[model samples]
Target: MKTKLFFFIFSLFFFLKSNAQCAMCRAVLENEEGQSAAKGINDGIIYLMSIPYILVFGLGFFVYWKYFRKKKVEA
Candidate 1:
């Protein structure tokens, strides 16, 4: 229960601060000129994040397929 509460508060803090900004932060993010750059950077971040998961899943899938095929052939 205590752990749960601590985790909840920790997560809440991060969520609240995730979009943390000052005036310049808001202006830059919202500005037309900065939007493309911001979006491109965000996209790169997403791509970087997604690569590891995609690679892991791809590897797991290949292993699963190989094992299943081998089992069928053995049977």
Candidate 2:
């Protein structure tokens, strides 16, 4: 478990930076003299993409905590 946790943390920090853009967006952004717009678009895309995964993970954690928590026995 410790190894897995360490690996997860290591992997998170060493992820490859992506310049993800659709073909049309890439074409438009590439023509600009400054690449800031392209970078911004890529960042926005990554941000939008991560939202659903975060929500699903949160819900799964809540469900696991609710269902698997220890119950108290009455005296």
Candidate 3:
């Protein structure tokens, strides 16, 4: 079980470096006339990448507040 979990984690790290680009997109972006489009593409990728992390953090904070925060007892 430990080995399987280790391998799964290792594979995830390997896949993290992979990009979402394809051959056609790469060609067009590389040969484009202006830099604005490439900048837009990079910004879009970053925007999309951040959404999941923001959602997870919000969920974690909610959970902590609901279950872990200390409650005051009524006198």
lDDT of 1 by residue, 1-75 (tens): 999889967975665434334467557677666377666655566557657867987999899999999999999
In order, the Cα lDDT scores of the candidates are: 0.70, 0.79, 0.72
* lDDT winner, 1 or 3: 3
What TM-score does model 2 achieve against the real structure? 0.67
lDDT, candidate 2, 1-75, per-residue tens: 999889967865654365568999999999999899889889899888768977997999898777666342221
Clashing residue pairs, candidate 2?
A: none
Model 3 TM-score relative to the real fold: 0.55
Index of the highest-lDDT prediction: 2
In model 1, residue pairs whose N, Cα or C atoms come closer than 3 Å (at least 3 residues apart or on different chains), thus clashing, are: none
Residues 1-63 of candidate 3 have per-residue lDDT tens digits of 999889967966765555555577767897988867876776677568768967997998898
